[model samples]
Target: MSKVDVYDVHLVETVASTTDVKPLPLATIDIRVPLPDELIHLSLEEQDSLERHIVRKMDRRLMPIIIVMFWLNILDRNSIANAKIAGLPKDLNMNNAQYNTCLLIFYVGYVITQLPSNAILPMVRPSIYIPLVTCAWGLMSMAQGFLHDFQSIMVVRFFIGVLEGPFFPGVIFLLSCWYKKEELIKRIAFLYAGNILSSCFGGLIAAGIIGGMEGVAGYAAWRWLFIIEGLVTVAVGILAMFLFPDYPRTTRWLTKEEGLFAEWRLSNEVAGIIDEDSSGIWWGVSEALRDPLTYLFTFMQMMLTTGQSFTYFLPSIIKTLGYNNTITLLLTAPPYAVAFLGSVALAYSSSKRKEFCMHICFPLTISVIGNILAMIVHGTGARYFAIFLMAFGVYVVYNVNYAWVSSSIPRPQAKRAASLAIINLMSGGATHFYTSYLFPDNDAPRYYMGGSALTVAVFLCAMTAITIRFYLARLNKKIDAAGGDAEAALRANKGHTETMKAFRYQLHWWTWPLPKALGTEVISIYHTSSKSADAAKIGKSNFIATSTEKWAEKHSRTLETILCTFFKNGTQLEEYILMLDVGGIMVYVEIPESALPPLPPGLITGNNFAPRESNTASKKEVLQMFKLKTDQKIKSWVEEVPMENCIEAVEKL
Candidate 1:
């Protein structure tokens, strides 16, 4: 018979004989059927090729739409800043502080909606939720064009903030659902590149509208900017509802085999904990609140975001060089364009090296230098150079920091969603509430006070990132000491993703101990055997007995000496036989003779073995007697061995 037919008969016979016996629990049964060679034994090159294919497919389908959505998201949210330079504040009869209030009020709605929006994301279809919110915000943004006074603009801005609040955090959470941690940084940087590019392109678009559309429709150029951008945003939002893939497991675009492979890859990478169900927003919030790193990183993000708030007033900052509105708007694009390239390079390095802290710290340090230079330098050329440095530094830090948050909190999707939203919400508040006051109109043309505060914030951000790095290092050390068992780390982390035995936080630098601290090797064994032998000649019970006897024979000398020596001294010796199946091949493993406990008298040893006292009336009677004794011994061993340890051993097989 063919090997497949023989195994099929064995399985059927085993099940039929056990029909009247109590069924084992599903977890206790080894039900994995053999797979075809093509599925089970793929070459490394084949695996890599498949991975590349999946990545390319995902990138082609997902990235462009996501990037464009983010571009529209940023353009709508920050267009007010561009409009201000085009005489928006003057046209609306708004003063400097009122304009800042408008900025600050938007964040009030922004902060209020973040937690709920993120919490609701997993419960609703993202394709529907995200696009609906995008469309709502687009309408609100368009309403800005019709507003004639400060209060009306503030109302529209606030509603726009409320509707737009979910997009950033929602997208971050969505990306995490599809990509592994190692793949996340570059993807996030690419998504963030959209934000940077919008600053560049938003400027060009705003300038074009302001220059050409000023008198064409009898509406102010600033009004045309809102109407045109808002219409574009609404259209994209409508399109994205159809384009966006929801999640890897649920996405219909992939074939069945591809979907299973994708899920398996992710589950293995995450140690098999892929929590898709919502565990409740409050539960997620509670978990995040308990993690002290959440507070530290959130505050760090807030400070970093607060310091980089100059992007909102880039036109105003450039205008300090005494350029006209058109020239100033055009000039704003170059710094952000430069920063986009810098951000991509930094993100690539971070992803390649699998590091986070250094990527963040290095950039923030450069930003600190830029802030100081802007404060000390008087020349326009020197100041513009300073702007380039500041823009590159702050934005790269922003992109990588969010990636860090996602990697650091990878499980129990609810908590991850909560943590991301909370950090973003607070950062938004900081951006508008604190950073707004930093750049008062009175401090224009060299806002020394603003620069100094930003300098201090950037320095604190660096210090905080370093501190967080050290804290994770300490946790890693504890994990290493526990023999790299994630359970120990989980105990220490109170069941957070930080305890995921396989998860490691990226450090600022590669240290000698970091690799050992981050991960440990798990040794595995596999055994293969031919299955063409006749079942009667090589029966399961006889094979097990023969294997056990052969193993005992190999260690006979040590076993006999130990048992004999112990028995002579009026003591007993105990030995154990551990049975395991590796790769469908049965193995009988014995404890080392030296480590065995005292054995009982008359136990068989290779050097001194004798048949047990028995009277055989018939061959059947003697055979039955041998079987009963062997069964009893096996039963005793099963009763003594810990079930948990047995389960663990089986899992290793």
Candidate 2:
């Protein structure tokens, strides 16, 4: 359903002269015309009150559900490192090179399909699409336990990557629509932090499973971990279908008022207009293409991902330390724990300040330092500290960038979806190339190539963040300049009236007085289609603009007989009140308040006006209501003859 907006004008006048040219009090200008209603009926203050309430409600109802499910998903899928150390590769006949190939293949499919899947998501229902995707990936991951050869494992992993493409992008888009940019960063960080937490706990969980459940059901402990974790993922995915919130407009749990407020609040915060007309998927993508910021965003994300490759193979890197399979897996948890702490702190700082470039750049610099240290050091003690730094430095930036993307591109639903997909896909595609190559077994005990590549990636990431920071600042400057242009146009119109005062003429009955202090009288004009002088008179036809300039020129003379204008609160109303010039000098007399009609219940003085006359009202009230105020007070009041049309007035003048 649609609503119509009623914009009423309120007029107040102070009579200066009550002599021969008496312009009676113009108590109000209330035009009850219809416009599309795009917001809730509440005032700004009410909306703010309700917004705070709804925000809390949504956070409580939705945040925990999304966080836990995402946390579980990250833990299960990302623990491939743990499995590698647990002897699964040997038992499954997988060589180190073949394992790398399987990992790379997963990303190959994951990277290629990211954009297309995100684009089509809304077509499949978000609730259905996300859960279905999750379940499919989970099933494939579980099947890893049964694979006996490299070919089978690679196929499963590839399919897993394809199905998982939408999870991060989809959730990011969801958060973008639900929260304002500043409010969304921490949430995105919370979600990304799950990846770090997974890194920390994957080994701990794997350690227990491998030690206690190795021979359960005649299956190896690694296989048990795969099957158990995979089945859990499938179950959670199914449950998520029931628990997940769909598109904001379609969510049934919210009240009608709540939903409308939610939609309008976000729209006001982001676009300054509500887009109930928009869609959820490709809007992000389309916005991405048109928005120059997306490219800068792409650069930031690419750099962060490059530095992040270290966490991806962290378990394998640890196994080279010569610990037994269980101990290596156990040892993996501590560095990940440190990384998790680093990421959460960085995310919190970035979100709180809404300063993405600084937060991301700082951590990336640290990662670069860590990578360099790792490259130069060889001692077990020194090298171990570098290893911890690798996770800590990389995770901080990775966590911050996800939040940044979710916040940056807003609206035209398709473009947002596309932008997120493109960013994610690019990151995945890079993983297949640079990230996979960094960990060749030949590097062995040192892994010099991996460390150096990470160092370069960190440096590049920092540079990209700095560049984007400046770009956003420049765009803001352009927006300010555009606003200034609009203000200048209004001021120019006001100056025209001041300079051309002698040419202005006023019909005695309609013209009102201006206060002495307010300077020269200036009013804007609108072209109306209706020919009636008192469109505000009893049951007269209303006017709509045909061609604004042509209508303005045509109606200029008659408008002197009918129209007048003044600023209610300085120049703020200059945009709304349309006027015509008769003579520059006009007099307005304020009538007693008792003479005006009572105001309506919802009306507020100064904000909502009560027009003195209505349908079939007295002619005196009609004339009084039409009189507008200007710069000087009227010394006298007069009821001059009303001309039938502007043509007659032009001839008389």
Candidate 3:
């Protein structure tokens, strides 16, 4: 309703009519999160600062509790290993076979429940759901303290697995809910750091409890270990419900402005609302079952898990290096510490640069070297160093792969949820049953059979990662060749129609020799359906919303003539989409160098441009909106007419 002068704005090109836009399905639109005025008027720097502040607050409040909960998660998971070294087998009258069974049993429960647990997460408040599960596992861990036989302990371990099953996959899904694809790996690194650091510190804590608390309660030190760790976990779980946030919209602590930005930032990232799915969980499962990426990612996870099976036996491995049990436990800390630093560093780089393949593949290649060295090397120091490398490679993949799964298969929160569970089901769950036997003490020290299997797994893991990187790169080029409908190209496996439009898949970009640019631009204007109240408010008469598509469809000659306008002076127009949404329709055209000057006869800003609090918005604002939404995929924008009054002016063109 106000004039936005463009004499000084560098962004708006002199386009007379609507051009092409991104394809936005009707299901993805949500109008409740309108742009805030204070935010609307700020310089880009101020907006960036506000975004950083929101992330900072979210991290401060969210990460520590997540870290602690996961810390307890892993601490409880590995408690059995620490218990084994502290006379758990001797006291419980069990052999190595029984101990391995216990290990396998827990994972059985853990894997089985994950798909269902993640499916339920969206239906419940995460604050309540995550905590409730954490507490259930805590109770199961405490029960491990009272068990009298291998049978009882195995039963307890299975329940512990069931209770703990959802934690990691669920955490991956939860983190994806809050972060952008670019922001995901770094946050996930911090999340996995809980698992990594627990190995470092959990060893120290278990060593202390097992060594000190043995005789105090007239109970085995191993029992004291379980009892104490379980108590700490229960306490942390209770605090989590109060500390953790659910989705941004439902969270209580954010200011209205903060809440709006939180929602907008993510909505802007996906070019759609990624909230709950109206469809059932099975539909998501079907979507996941059909995506080729799901199987590829699952295989990668399986290799990574099998490659890192040494984690279950690191204590025994170090003990073989001439240390006693206690010293062996202490030695486990250093490698994990190094892995933690490496992981956090890699995660930061991956997130900052928004690249994953090299970050992932290169480390795994190093692991291959480490695995080879372990197989042939005879010296103690060299063996220990190889162990460090082995530990580093797989855990790093653990975080990166989860982030990749979330990013690559993103959407239908249900599909994302199901995909992760289905993946972990094989890699984290079923693989454990076999990996548990790979390092039987009979193969200790050299354990060439175990080391050999692990080496191939690591090598295959690296090659598979490289394969995926190139496959994705090829797909990006194909989508470009097809135009810009990433939505259709990605869903091609699901019987969706193929069109000339494609989306650039942005995860990692290798220096693959891509062809030089033939210019193409797209502008998507997303308007609510006509049945919605917001449709009437999109523009006066809703011409751009309800009838623009029809007009364009009906008037082929008029559209062809309009297209002819930009094919002037030897410059060309490649292709574009005209998607109308609650905002405005976006038109794509390349302005020739000669088209730069002279105001049109009647211009008073633009209408139905990017999401804004007021139509008093600028071209710069619209481009900024796209920059935030597409992560700069739609970097350059042609302006829509500035006001509804200009609708007449646009028609005159």
Q: Which candidate has the highest TM-score of all?
A: 3
Scored by lDDT, the top model is: 1
Q: How far is candidate 1 from the true structure (C-alpha RMSD, Å)?
A: 16.9
Write one digit per residue (lDDT tens) for candidate 2, span 130-249.
888888888888998888877888888888888877787777777777776667767777777777777677788888998889888889888888888888889989998887787666
User: Candidate 1 regions off by >4 Å?
Assistant: 1-49, 493-499, 508-653
Worst 10 residues of 1 by lDDT: 1-10
Across 191-270, the per-residue lDDT of candidate 3 in tens digits comes to 88888999999889877887678787688888988998998889989989899888877788788778778877765555
Q: What would the per-residue lDDT of candidate 1 be over residues 284-364, giving only the tens digit for each residue?
A: 888887777788889889888877889788889999989988888889899889889889998888876567788888888
Q: What ranges in model 2 sit over 4 Å off?
A: 1-45, 273-287, 484-653
In model 3, which runs have C-alpha deviations exceeding 4 angstroms?
Answer: 1-49, 493-503, 509-653
Worst 10 residues of 3 by lDDT: 1-10
Error of 3 at 205 (Å): 1.2
Note the Cα lDDT for every prediction shown: 0.68, 0.60, 0.67
TM-score of each: 0.72, 0.68, 0.73
Order of the predicted models by lDDT, top scorer first: 1, 3, 2
TM-score for model 1? 0.72
Candidate ranking (TM-score, best to worst) = 3, 1, 2
Error of 3 at 454 (Å): 0.9
* Candidate 2, run of 10 with poorest lDDT: 499-508
